[model samples]
Target: MNVIIWNCRGASKPSFKKRVRELVQNHNPAILVVMETRVGGDRAREITNLLPFDEAIHTDATSYAGGLWVLWNADRVDITLLSSTEHEIHAKVKVRFTNVSWLLSAVYASPRNAERQILWKNLMNVAELHNLPWVIAGDFNEPLLSEDKFGGRSVSVNRSLLFKECLDKCKMLDFGFAGPRFTWTNRREVQALI
Candidate 1:
């Protein structure tokens, strides 16, 4: 089943909602993970209205810093919310047609480099604890290679290596991506950003 994981940055913007709707229409994902929402309360409800998912679980923002929304098509998949935190949402998803279950971890990794290592350690612990077939995805904030960076400054090799080591230690494979080479584009013409 197709699952779409996105770090939306914020959902309050009309443009973001429109883009999300387009993505939903295009991909028709069985499960959807939206991270860094930066909005809550009525705006969250408004964001949900624009999507096709029947059921949703939300983690509210902490002072405009982070938020999470996990949406799933109830008719297609049965989802059990196992656990959640400011950085991750763990769930067990069973596809009704296949009668198969797997663990899904939706992560919004801390942008802070130091904190990211801790996040990786926690995720590794989860991996060790749960032997279930797992598919973990989100905006990890660390690119694995030079090619992974589209237009940004040279990525930190140490950060990339740490991420790679964690994945290797956990025996997880990169599912890779399709469509856009860069998930983000800095169109603002900012010098330091690029």
Candidate 2:
């Protein structure tokens, strides 16, 4: 099934809403996974209503960072919110078209290497327990390889290795980076600084 994952930075911009609409019309994904939504409860509800999706789940906005939301086209998918933590959300659902069951986890990793390692470990544990076809998608905040970056920066050998190991151990594929080579930019307008 088609799925879209984006870290919108925040949902405050009119551009963000316009882009979401465009994505829905153009991609028509069964599921839309959004990160850094920067909205909670009422605002989240308002935003979800504007989208074509029938249901949405988001964490408490009071949390340190704005939370995640999974918007699903109810006609094409049956979504059961399995669990949610401060940094991730887990769901168990079947893709309507293929009838493929998936243990889907959408995550936004901490920028710090140490915290990310811990998060990855925890995520891997959950995946191992389920033993179902799984997809983990979000702003990992760490490039998998030197090639993933625009210019040569010292790729964190240990962190990169751990990320790869976690995915391999969990049997989840990276799916290859799509759209822009870099998903984030700095205020300076310098490209590929992430």
Candidate 3:
């Protein structure tokens, strides 16, 4: 079973539904985690209903920023909500017709260093609560290494240090990426990856 996690920036855009539909059609993921929705309330509900997923849970956007939506196909997988904060959604997923069961934490970490520290701590608490095989994925908003970033101020070892410590304590390792060394860029003349 495949899970697709996307930081879509904003879900209120005119093409949001079309883009999501295409992703669903192309990838056919059992679960789709959307971060940074920047929308909530009635509008969020409307959008979720339009999507192809059979079930969904949304962490509403605060003001104009930060929202997370976890959608899944009920026929393909059964998902049980574990807990959630503005920064993450923790759940247990069981694939249909199988004995497989695991924890999935979809994160949308804050850009602020302090807030992200809280996220790390919360994740550690969650880890201690369950021994099931776990998959944690999303936009951490903090690069874990100097090499994970390019073009801009040098990475702050202090921040990366905390992140690394959290990973070590949680016994989690970066899955890394293919295709591009950097998944994000500033898009200006002075481009940086994170």
Output the number of the TM-score-best candidate. 3
lDDT of 3 by residue, 3-107 (tens): 898889999999999998999889899999999999887888899998999999888888879999999999999999989988899999999999999999999
Better of 2 and 3 by lDDT: 3
Tens digit of per-residue lDDT, candidate 2, span 1-194? 68999888787678988998899889888899998877777888888888788888786544546578888988888889888875688898787767578877888776667878887888878866887877888877777788876653678888889999888887877667657766555645455454
Error of 2 at 87 (Å): 1.5
Give model 1's clash tally: 0
Rank candidates by lDDT, best first.
Answer: 3, 1, 2
The lDDT per prediction is 0.83, 0.79, 0.89
Clashing pairs in 1: none
- Cα lDDT, model 2, residue 22: 94
The parts of candidate 3 lying over 4 Å away from their true place are 190-194
Residue 29 accuracy (lDDT) in model 3: 92
Candidate 1 lDDT tens digits, 67-140:
88889999999999998777788899999889699998888877788878888898888888988899888878
Top lDDT model: 3
In model 2, state the lDDT of residue 77. 87
TM-score, per-candidate, Cα-based: 0.85, 0.86, 0.93
TM-score of 3: 0.93
